[model samples]
Target: MQKATGQDGGEAAVVGTDGTGPADASGLTGDGTGPLAGIVVADLSRVLAGPYCTMLLADLGATVIKVESPGGDDTRTWRPPVHGDMSTYFMSANRNKHSIALDMKDPEQLELVHRIVGEADVLVENFKPGGLAKYGLDADSVAERWPHLVHASITGFGTAAGAHLPGYDMLVQGVSGFMSLTGETDGPPQKGGVAMMDVMTGLHCAVAILAALREREGSGRGQHVELNLFMTALSGLVNQTSAYVAGGAVPRRMGNDHPSLFPYGPFACRDTDLIISVGNDRQFARLAEVLGMPELAQDEKFATMSARNENRDELRALMVGRLGERDAQQWQDELVEVGVPCAPILGVDEGIAYAEKLGLDPVADAGGVPTVRHPVDYSRTPARHVKAPPHLDEDREAVLAWLEGRGADCEG
Candidate 1:
């Protein structure tokens, strides 16, 4: 529940919505309470996926050393959303980690990378299948050198023929059939507003890496873990994919509508858009009553789950007709009081504020930087913020000094 004050007292390693790092660290590196306190991560991933995965690891109290190119993370230049030239995109991840720039094209710099990778407990990357082989950082090569290092790699695709293809999140979103199901039924396919696959892949990769690390506890050896945006997107399809695979159904775009559930997506009210996610017949009865249409519960055409789904359009028309008489908020308040799951559509800022209003504490201060709170909550060893995202290679001197102290025999 404590905020990260950062190890250097410079900036709390946090993704700040305010576009600034927290500069005042409370002078604590945690008392080694986080489950990952002594763990170390060598993060070399760029853009959203890798950085986000590593940032989550860092939040869990890992000493993540962000290894960047001489140009630093490519996101550093994704601008317009900049905090004094420091890309907010970059700040979105890469917190609570040490950073050092090592140009692999240079032999000496590559050597430094090897040294760090050798010492790190975990290494994360998002290069193409054969991308890191030239620098001798491939999973096979690193495994030979450091048998105890957990090597996790993220790719757009697997190491098959598609390995060379770019792994842009939007591309995966479309290619993975998400776009086909998004947007209005009559509109062209549309991708999610955010980097959906990238973040999903990151989350998946983190879980895999954590599982691998746990397995290593017994084997006394590390392993190579891999994930890709394409596979991740497909897996994330969840019920949509299940419907197709299990029932031989091909889902089409149904804007603001659920495939097998009636009144389970967004609906327009008198004022604003609201979501009425009715799950079962009971909730349907509640909703029908709330709308002063108790007859809906008795109507055989809409009495059961299957009937309601089959007649969703008819149901929607009836529900909307009644809902349009009352504003979204008024309906939301009434429905919520009766245990119906519903909410007015929200902006990102409003969502955060709403979480705060509900005591979720969605925001946290990392040192002086304002950042989103960690998504997980550990009863004993919760995630902690300790340092702000590094200013490209800002920790070069310190990291090298620490390495030098570890001596030439740092990692066997």
Candidate 2:
């Protein structure tokens, strides 16, 4: 395994391994073997969306220098759930990167920031439409100064009519009609438990940045990439949005039930609820066999997928009656054995444990902090968990040294 020097000149982490090894001094990993090993990102955004996008790039082996204000990212104080002195929430989206604090109001510090952006391959910011214009760090300003830079901007809404509105995931959920479709049929509109809009927007921003970087290779110039939470929320709604636009049908909440497919939601068993997803007529037939009602697959009422959907009320009654004969775990085992898609409801811990049982290895250690692993795996160049999230201005000295051409690696 390859090793990197930590701030204290001790071994920080083992890089180029499977990421399940001893902790490093720098809390960093990776051996410059990732696909994006040589790339540099100037992360000017704070909070979830911008940080999340930059973290993805960092995992893929980019040298991400997180530029925060003197107060640091707002999430540093979003605590009650913390690790040591850092917020776990903040840590969730910030890893494998170095952090430095700089106040743009200070002319010297702003100059330093400009130098960083000038050297970086990409710049990511989530400031409101014109929030960065005063600092001369906005898209147009950056394009004029650094034509080879990929400038990616994220907002709550587009720059035109909705620029004044603050961007928040829950607010976008309400405005984009996601909340309206999230709850039970009779219940009040509800937001998702997580900030899904922010996450989706981050993913969209990352893709756009990658595309612009690819284009720059061909044209020797970069372009501005823009994304907004409201638009991302609409695109993420997928089928529901299509239902309204393409079919002229407004969708409504249906509890855990799917709008188009029957036998695709949770059903009560003897001891607990189990989700049985039947995607096609053949899967429905296999499910019928598992329930000891093979004849139901041939019945006119439930024979075809459309017929089963149309008569879901009656078919659900029958299936529920049959499922009630066995415990959810028992049914899960039998259904899975026959290739019918089914699983008992699991808590978050149980879900992680299940993934572990299946050899997915969903957790990784950054320095000493535990984190969810990056979701993608590459054959030639896998994602790396280089460093733990930084403390407020923790890497100031090394970053400054690098800025001064000293070539020093940041301390943990």
Candidate 3:
């Protein structure tokens, strides 16, 4: 129930009570008070998606052992933004885990990995479909050896026809039709700023792993959970995909505008742009009142959600003129006061500052490194942040000692 302070002096979320505080020198993995306190995760994935999924498990108090190749994870070299000697990109998804470098092709190392998988509650890997078959780490192989282990595999595409295609976030974005729906209506397709498809696939993989674990409780047996980035991207498209599959409509790029809602995108104010979202007719009426144009809400063309959406061009023209009369912050304050959801577009730093101001601690300390906190808050069992991201082969001795039954303390 205690909170830590960020370097900026802002209070962070409650920690320590459930073993969710900073790491101790004792080499314990977590406080064993988190939901997944006793869970052991064998992380054989690299880069973003698989690492990201296992990181979530680690945050929830799982003892994650990251098995890396001799050169380590690809993200280790993905730098320009480094934290000391490590890549920030690598740190972003690797906190709270132990790392041991091993050549998967070596008989000794492969045997060690089998032992790790034997003791793991979950095994996550993102190799090409059937890539691990040679090493006996594939889902079927692992399931045969460890019937109680949840085996999750991630690929760029499915195991069937698209297995040959490498899965990268931008490739999935383009192939899944996400890029087609981004950017200005008249401009070429665009990819998102971040690796959205990889992130989404990781989230989906986490949910699937959890579900498989829950099912294991009743059956007392584990199963294979397979996910692909292409599918995840398609599902993540959500309403856009629904528009095509169910409504027989193909959605296209419209820049920042919402296809079905008026006043849902950014509008220019006197000094800056503000995003105004008027979800329903009541909110539209309130927005009109705040704009000193109450009659606009009564007009047949803008009276209802559907009507406003139908005549968004005219409504946008009117709203834009009224919004331009004042600065973005002034209009945002007034509109928000009237229950209309609105805000000035904020940069990433400003967004974090706003979250801190709202008492939602978005950052946490992992050992001495600052990383984004887990998104969820549990009343009884909080997420832990006891370890910092490890350097390549950083925890080899400890991990090997634990794996070999040497009584090494590896988990809180």
Candidate 3 residue lDDT tens string, 242-342:
99999999998999988888879899999989999888999999999999999988999999988998999898898888888899989888887888998
Clashes of each: 9, 5, 1
Model 2 TM-score is 0.91
TM-score list, all predictions: 0.91, 0.91, 0.92
Ranking by lDDT: 3, 2, 1
Per-candidate local distance difference test: 0.80, 0.83, 0.84
Q: Name the regions of candidate 2 deviating beyond 4 angstroms.
A: 1-30, 406-412
TM-score: which is higher, 2 or 3?
A: 3
Alpha-carbon runs more than 4 Å astray in model 3: 1-28, 406-412
Candidate 1: give the clashing pairs. 4-385, 6-386, 12-387, 12-388, 13-387, 13-388, 22-368, 22-369, 23-368
Model 2 alpha-carbon miss at residue 85, Å: 1.8
| Best candidate, TM-score | 3
Error of 2 at 89 (Å): 0.5
Worst 10 residues of 3 by lDDT: 4-13
> If both were scored by lDDT, which would come out higher, candidate 1 or candidate 3?
3
